[model samples]
Target: MFRLLVMRGFALLLLAAPAAGAVEEALPNESAAHLSTLGRKPDWSELDKYQATITHDEFVQLFRQIYATRGCNPDLIKVELDVARILTAAETQNYFVLHFAKGEADRRPVPRWWAVPGALPNEARTAGPLAGFHIALDPGHLGGTWAQMEERWFRIGDAPPVEEGNMTLQVARLLKPRLQSLGAKVSLVREKAEPVTPYRPSDFEEIARQLLLRTGVKDARENFDGPADPEKEQTIAWQRELLFYRNSEIRRRASVINHRLQPDLVLCLHFNAEPWGDPHHP
Candidate 1:
């Protein structure tokens, strides 16, 4: 009788093994052929129609449903607002892309849901209220040597001075970890105290000329026959450079936020300063 009972237990274990294996199976990796469809160009007309009818929340819900239907782990996909309103044709094809890990284990060209780090089971979101939110922090202005040119730096007396760019970067760094701890995905538009765009002042020399002339820095009367003195020429050039850098940096940051990160919310940090009432007093 004991031998018969042991045989019965072994049979039961064999029967349960397939169920356990199915539960433990990783999400299937997409094939290159399957991924090709994801890269298809968007029909702008269709996208416009969808944009008219589909609210942001509805799009997110639709994405989640599609993700599940594709046999992908829902945690591997993230949906953001695309608030910059600069979605490229490729990005417009899908609400979100599957994020994967790097290295030998994930040699597949296409992303695998199991490769995504910190991709908890769909049921694990109960731990944090913001489990699936994406947030972006944009620190305003170019700091470092460009701070003075950006007009975001001011020194009073022997004080260390205040730089808006540096201050915003610090704030973003502090806020990133806190948001991540709360289970929110966070990204910084400008990670450091530098310009995001590769454009330089010299690139927009013509625009700079118009700006300087308009601003009276290059007066027609004073420099009718070109700059009269080296000082006047230097002043015009500096103003032109500043204008180019300022506008280019802003445009680049917007591109990064809209095309690349596409976070649900954008927090632009800036520090405003008023002219000192008495420079010597405080």
Candidate 2:
């Protein structure tokens, strides 16, 4: 569900108005003073001091308080229910988890009070403007064998074909160094044509079936009078692959971003296409 929300939120991010600028900038001395007052790190030990469990609503309230105190924008953050752990009857409770792109908002005009404690060694802090920032680049789509099926590949006449997945990857590769030169740490969600998630069609056959049914790619009552046609069979297979790529594959990428990389900011790169009235004109 968190994966679904993240995927859906990308559209909102693209459509949102440019963030309003910070009300005021913190001077270096003021930044240092703020850091001193806020302390050097969050107290994780406090977690052990709290009750073992809390209602989902309680967690949301707590998270809101924490976010407000830290001046985070609630509108930009997403909170979702996590129910992966429920081994016992008493443990069958749902909990809420917050997900957001750290440092991606102009709302945080003031610099963070303390640097991520272990993010940098003492010497590297002098690297450049983005010295301590971490950015994750997610070049969208599985381009290799799935480009055409994903509807991200197009060719008109003798001109070179356009592949959105491949293009985004190239962009990410090129942008990495430019950001790095400014001292930001960078990671790519996928460095190659393959998906980051290990899931395959066989692993979620039921999901594929449902997706095909919902999309009208397959029908319960429609059947050929004779034996199955090879071409139709092939089309069905491709449709399943499309469903897996769109749903499962993307969710896996979200998992990698939220759990494994956990970078301060995430960028999903892609290209848009429009109808070509004349193949050669544009």
Candidate 3:
């Protein structure tokens, strides 16, 4: 069924750079800093490579049609005449600006590590359409023991539980060889159901406490391992586990794909299902 589904290829841009003086205001103290569960500060200078690669119209189109629609608030991104200002840190004035190309003639050649189809040699083109392509297959989640925790496991009556992570891995395993057969270099983000992140839930405990405090949870405290308040302790534990499986794990996978593999294309496999209230029932 998945084989019959057509997957459209798209560019995934990761641009960053320090905000200009106009957008960079006084930052809050460390304790009052705002960040994602386990996210770090962005290095905006990375956007330098993408400078003048897209026209103002093109940038606005992609921003509105793609990025903005992806759960991003309109107020977070301001499209200007020559640049798009994106808010990097919420509750702060920190912003990242992406300068737009004047026009098609003014656009510079995009700096990219992957070889484009038009750039491939005649010999490679004759081999296959994907002859010089480097593709990475990313299985969606960590299955096995983490399937239930990630809520990707479901069962109907006495049927075996449907594990999305392992299933996606199986598809990737089957697809890798097929892509290689087309003369493409292929890499898997993960081969098994284990996590790629070295840090576990315990490692994120401190970070979780900080995140809770930012949310105005007054009970949050540092070096808090005692069970003085079980309810609050449970909330902290839950937050830690969520950060481990959701934030840390995906970030590690992205690092492997962007830095290690540097693939031209990435196929992230997953099964999208409607919310079924109880796993046992559906």
Candidate 4:
């Protein structure tokens, strides 16, 4: 009998969800090929050495470097790194200690289960929750970023993460790693570097103002909707060019997003408002 390992300060739950006849679905077969990138779990002795040699921060950092270096993944690395921060290394030590030594504990006392630390085999979720996964996503468009003014996303209404820049940063972060794990090669448009990226706050403001002026919405209300006032015409012309230009810049970054953070699907958000008042933000 393969005795199950119980966690410390954690209890692993299991259930054999059955079909209408109360019979379970056939277990999903886990092939080594599907998990080849994951490498192998540590032996208890290796865990001991890992415990003895690695500090909490060091443990996390080492794994981060491992993920980045081995081409394992970034997001999973980040999640694991977060897990390291969630509890002291001491907790990790205790958990593993109970795991290897106390196999005598009742083997989970439940139905079919997955071992923790080990994610559910890709095969397990392959059909049930994994089949035709639907995702709702957004991205940094028209040069949004965490540090810049909020007005851009405000007008659009479908806000991005904080700022367009940082949102892009995070989006790229999630996108590249996840797809790469599943055997993908992604190319991002705007990295955290110069040119083809969102502008700084001052620059974004100037750009926005320039764009607003070009729109002729700045023209007096008396000038509203005519055979097109010449000044307003100039504004409209500039607005069209500027909006397209800004969007081009965004797509330049998006082009990076397209290549590097490529997903099987893309969702873009466009919103229209009353064109009055400041938009909501936290």
136, model 4: CA deviation in Å?
17
- Each prediction's total of clashing residue pairs, residues at least 3 apart in sequence or on different chains, is 0, 0, 3, 15
Where in model 1 is the C-alpha error above 4 Å?
1-125, 211-235, 279-282
What CA RMSD would you report for each candidate? Answer: 21.4, 15.6, 8.7, 21.6
- Residue 277 in candidate 3 has what lDDT? 75
Per-residue lDDT of model 3, residues 70-122, tens digit only: 43445566778898776666578877788899999999987766666678888
Overall lDDT per candidate, in order of appearance: 0.51, 0.52, 0.69, 0.34
* Per-residue lDDT over 34-101 for candidate 2, one digit per residue giving the tens place of the 0 to 100 score: 12211122222222222224444654565445324343333334344531121111134432332222
Candidate 1 lDDT over 29-99, as tens digits, reads 22112112112222223222122233455445544454233333323233445321322223253442322
How would you order the candidates by TM-score, starting with the best?
3, 2, 1, 4
Cα lDDT of model 3 overall? Answer: 0.69
In candidate 4, residue 232 scores what lDDT? 45
In terms of lDDT, which candidate is strongest?
Answer: 3
* Global fold similarity of model 2 (TM-score): 0.51
Instruction: State the RMSD for candidate 1.
Output: 21.4
For each candidate, what TM-score against the reference? 0.50, 0.51, 0.73, 0.26
For candidate 1, give the lDDT. Answer: 0.51
Clashes of 3: 3
lDDT of 3 at 51: 80
